[model samples]
Target: MSIQVGDTLPDVEIRVVSNGIEEGRTGPLFAGRKVVLFAVPGAFTPTCSNRHLPGYVQHLAQFQARGVEVMCLAVNDAYVMQAWAASQNVPPELLMLADGNGNFTKAMGLELDGNAYGMGLRARRFALYAENGVVKALQVEAPGEFRVSTAEAILEALA
Candidate 1:
């Protein structure tokens, strides 16, 4: 089942780049804070790179205006995620995390198989509004869909 609204987010390990060095961070970054967590299937994928990510990039100011901290999570490594963020010009304020090995994605129950495309476990496209480490709004897609989970949708929910 998907992580529903009001579910307490699981504690998962994250890789963080500090001064060009990669280190693992545990516990939850969203603890005691409001966050907009988004998951995508893969990095550099069509819809993901094009519409999904850009929507967040474009409306980041609006999200922040409402006191929301937006974060993007993927089942990719820290290196790839950092590169993708740079390539897409995502702002520094937004948290783009790498959930490598699917530990966090699996914990959120949003894991998907992209073996046909040579990609293993990945996260489905979705978005959640979390406050103080607990979910307040949830939007898991309908498998091949990507409408409501966009940043604009999350912004609407936040508003």
Candidate 2:
């Protein structure tokens, strides 16, 4: 089953580029803080690059104003995530995380099989709000849709 509102996020290893690519875990990242993490199927994909990520970038400050940290995740490698972040001019406050092996994605039951499109296991387009490691809200989109997982939608959910 997919992770739900009361679920404590699985502690799984992930990669983030801090001076260089470094290992981190989900549990500590979400512990003692409110976080809004949004996942895309891949980095630099058309919809993700043009719309999904930009929405978050534009509204990042608004999220922070509510005491929530914003994060963008993809199944790509840490190098690709870093490049994408630089290309997008993403602020340092908005974390760019890589789930290269999809361990965390699978653990959350949010893995998307994109073999038909030549993409491998990937993360479904979704976003979740958590407080102190416990999920408080989740919005998952339907296949080929991009409706509920946008930054505005999550902000509305928070309200």
Model 2 stretches astray by more than 4 angstroms: none
Per-model TM-score on C-alpha atoms: 0.92, 0.97
lDDT (tens digit, per residue) of candidate 1 on 32-61:
787888889988889999999889999988
lDDT for position 32 in model 2: 98
Q: Output the number of the lDDT-best candidate.
A: 2
What's the residue-level lDDT of 145 in candidate 2? Answer: 95
Cα lDDT over the full model 1:
0.83
The TM-score of candidate 1 is 0.92
Instruction: Mark the 10 consecutive residues where model 1 has the least summed lDDT.
Output: 17-26
Q: Local distance difference test, per candidate?
A: 0.83, 0.93
Summed backbone clashes in each candidate are: 0, 0
Would you list the clashing residue pairs of candidate 2? none
Off by over 4 Å in 1: 17-26
